[model samples]
Target: MGMSDKMVTVLRRQFEPTVEMLKNLIEVCPDDFWFDAKHKYWKQIFHATTSMKFWFRQQKDEEFIIPDFGKDVTEDLDKECSDYPTKEEMKNYVEEISSVARKFFDELTDDKLLEPCVLYEEITRTDVILMQIRHVQHHIGYCNNILNSNHLEAAKWL
Candidate 1:
């Protein structure tokens, strides 16, 4: 019923849907298709999830200032992308991140929610969280686009 609680609620709500969308995208295409650099579907998901984890760790450390990737942000996700983990690996990544997020939410105090913290050096914590949500949405949109382009369909979320 406090600000922290509300924020955590919103985050938790977004988490499951985001993971489901990623799973759907992965399921729609074969492993080879995901490795295709031309489509960049897996690349988008990889970057988004990896970046999220990086930011989450920074936040937990109360570092406030976000690390800069500089121009690397523009690199195509699929270029030299062989390091990507397997589908099972990705699922484990999601589960681990989700668990950390839940812990952060449970322990977050209302005062901390209101405290101003720098994100990415210039942005605030509030903005960082918002960006995180948007990042999830962006990847999901990419997945939808890929599915559509391939004339494939994602399973409806029940």
Candidate 2:
């Protein structure tokens, strides 16, 4: 495989399974926990999806629009939203991020990967990819901990 092709494959391997893990997390999370006013599991999911979505297209110059259910993604981010998204909306948001990520990775070129990430001249797109992956996984761990604590089934490690 060409370098771009290889990077694409590696990126997909890193991302796809994690996102799937997240999808399973969403499905397995009980409604009581997901919607809990104090616990805010849904907000955690929202932060994960929004961060992934933002990293791909909005981190530097673009704007991020929250899903129809919520207003703007404010400074408080996961919190401070008056309207909460339903479980299905959260699921669809994850699916949408997965789809967008698939396209982004599929189009990766060696030049594109080497290009400086807008975050900093020293940081390349490759760095951004790894950073985003780590960010998502951190949230996954948080969510999984919540599930395990509640005596509920959580997504297993991929």
Candidate 3:
């Protein structure tokens, strides 16, 4: 397989399903337990999706548009948060950003992978995708902790 093919395989086989797993995890959480100031379940999703979409878009240009979460990221600090979306809306957000991610994979080229990108430290385009995977999984586990402690079933990848 070529470099591009390897990149696509890794994303399709790994990152994509992990995203689906995150979606499944959110779907299974009881509505009552879905939100909490301390838990930040919804906030995590926003951050994850925003970061994924933002960084992926960054690969093309510096002018990246943040996802419309109906509120700015700064609002997350507010004690009385507003403009939060329903779980259904969040699911839709995931689907939308996931499409962007899929497109990134589809357009993957060996040269693109070698392109310079930065996420905390200097990295390549391929490493940016890897960084996104880690970031999403980190938050997924954060949500999982809440679910597991609450006696809710954690999502299993199919």
lDDT of 2 by residue, 15-112 (tens): 88888888888888888887676666777777878877876762466666766565433224435655567789888889998887776676576668
| Candidate 2: Cα lDDT at 83 | 56
Q: Show pairs that collide, candidate 2.
A: none
Selected candidate, larger lDDT, 1 vs 3: 3
**lDDT-superior candidate, 1 or 2:** 2
The lowest-lDDT stretch of 10 consecutive residues in candidate 1 is: 66-75
In order of TM-score, best first, we have 2, 3, 1
Off by over 4 Å in 2: 1-4, 58-61, 68-78, 118-120
**lDDT value for candidate 2?**
0.75
Best by lDDT: 2
**How high is each candidate's TM-score?**
0.70, 0.84, 0.80
What are the Cα lDDT values of the candidates? 0.59, 0.75, 0.72
Candidate 2 weakest lDDT stretch, 10 residues: 70-79
Better of 2 and 3 by TM-score: 2
Tens-place lDDT digits, model 3, residues 1-158: 36547656766687887788778866887877666656677777767887787777644445666555565332233345644667887898888889988877777765567767644346777777888888988878888888888888877745
lDDT sort, best first: 2, 3, 1
Report, for all candidates in order, the number of backbone clashes.
0, 0, 0
